[model samples]
Target: MMNKPYVIGIAGSSGSGKTFFLKSFLNHFKSDQVTLISQDDYYIPANTKTREENRLYNFDIPTSINRADFYKDIKQLFEGQTVFREEYTFNNPDLKPQMLEIKPAPILIVEGLFIFHYTEVNELLDYRIFLDADESVALDRRLRRDLIERGYDEEDVMYKWTNHVVPSYQEYLLPHKEECDLVIINNTDDPKVIDEAANKISVELHEKNSTLNII
Candidate 1:
């Protein structure tokens, strides 16, 4: 049986390079040694909203997530139960969502914009990492991602950035920055810094959990 996992909570503002950092971090270990539970998958479906209304819907707030269910699943994982979740596709018509099977591992990573804000989820985190970036840099990355990947127009992206994302970051995420065990500032285009940070963190985690085999 797997021992109690060392849980890591990762949070950042929108476009703070979390996706990139996570990709780098996961590379250090075999897939079975680590499990990732992303808050994006726990978004409450807004099927009633029209296309135009969907653009106006504020998904940046903590209320937009099914926090109760998210916490329950995490608890189940801690109890050595495997969890299954439907992948959230951002309402993209062309993308087909998959069923994600998450098994308990020595290292569990919970990532989201509001993971730190949700009190129950925050309490489960053994370590916390916050990604930081300049406002202009994050805004630019958000614009490109929403426009190309999510099929959002420039106007809608800017509207959400100004009205929803920025406010939520200030109110929910930024306040918890100092509480994090590690803070990574990712402003430059080069991702080498992120890889280096991930390597260092992974080494320490492996040292703590000696059962985790390095790949």
Candidate 2:
């Protein structure tokens, strides 16, 4: 592992193509050179809370995550240490200890909604990217993903989108966009856009590494 790993933060409103951008970015390099840590996985497990009550929880809010632990893990990874990453089961509350073993790499990426909300996490980022998309486009994508992948119905998706997602974006996520190193408009399903962004990031990383080597 490299002594100093480069960390990238990809943040966006819910369903704004953060995951897609992350996947496309990862495709630019060898699998072993990059590591991914999703903020979605750092959600605190609802232990005694009933399923219905858990459904009412505003997961989009910063308080919904165990931020301290998440930051600790990220810091560990930055220091070239192995971390037991959490595997969040979106709609499934019964699964215990959603953890996975992850090794350190030269490039580390952490993506999610409210990723920049935590001060410590934000300070650790070498590059920050904010993905932007139309609210309607995001809603449509979120509805489809939740219905097919997360086992949510139309009503539940709409309810959460209207109540939790939009409000949280206005309050927590949107304000941080102005501070991002790059603001990518990702309204379309275009590979070229992703490639361009990833290439730019790769160049920035190469330059940083080269400077360190020269020193």
Candidate 3:
């Protein structure tokens, strides 16, 4: 049997530096040898029924994603096979059916809030990382990103964070931290910590390869 590629999962609260860590790790590996699979891509289309119930559209929790497709894509990555998948654009309800012809890369990194939330994805990872950030810091980052990029105002952003993001983080994201192989606290601007964590993961992967034939 052929050796399966290493699978890594990076989970975190919003704006907790998972993206930075992922980029840092990618820098260490050749592009052909690494592929990034984000849970953000698995978000479900906004249902008017659900949106009306909540009064706000949040793509943060488990139900936000298309469970069937997400599980299937994770399975493909875990098997060292390729899958063409959809990219989830925030609040875009239409599915255009664009296919990205993905080849199986040797290192697969999956990052998101709910990657660890679901059992199928959790089981597929060889190693997992959880990002820990202070609530204030996370909120500040979210506010800035939403206001500048997503066209949300300060009052609405603050209200959304208080009501939706923070509570969801505690209830859904925090409890799953213990499931990860490592938990790193994210620094807002300075990514020294993110780089360190990525380096450590590289070292650990190398060590595992040398000792246990864990390719």
How do the predictions measure up, each by TM-score? Answer: 0.96, 0.88, 0.84
Q: Residue-wise lDDT of candidate 2 within 1-215, one digit each (tens)? A: 54767788898877678777787788777767788888878888764676567667778888889898888888888777998876888755444554687778878888877678888888888889998889988898898888887776687788889999999999888999899999988788776887788788876666766533311
Give the range where candidate 3 is weakest over 10 consecutive residues by summed lDDT.
46-55
Instruction: Tell me the tens digit of each residue's lDDT in model 3 across 1-215.
Output: 22566788888888787767788988876667677877777776564445444346665567877878877876776676778876654543443446565666767787777777788778878888888788888887888787776655687677678787888889887998887788898855787878887998887776766443434
Q: How does each model score on lDDT?
A: 0.90, 0.80, 0.74
What lDDT is reached at residue 9 by model 2?
A: 89
Between the candidate structures 1 and 2, which one is better when assessed by lDDT?
A: 1
lDDT score, candidate 2:
0.80
Better of 2 and 3 by TM-score: 2
Candidate ranking under lDDT, highest first, comes to 1, 2, 3
Q: Is candidate 1 or candidate 3 better by TM-score?
A: 1
Tens-digit per-residue lDDT, 73-158, candidate 1 = 99889898999999998988878899999999888999999898998899999999999899999999998898889888899999
Candidate 3 residue runs with Cα over 4 Å from true position: 47-55, 92-101, 209-215
Off by over 4 Å in 1: 211-215
Span of 10 residues, lowest total lDDT, candidate 1: 206-215
Q: Which of the predicted structures, 2 or 3, would earn the higher lDDT when compared with the native?
A: 2
Query: Which candidate should be chosen as best, given lDDT against the real structure?
Result: 1
User: What TM-score does structure 1 among the candidates reach?
Assistant: 0.96
Candidate 2: how many backbone clashes?
A: 1
Supply every candidate's count of residue pairs whose N, Cα or C atoms clash at under 3 angstroms: 0, 1, 0
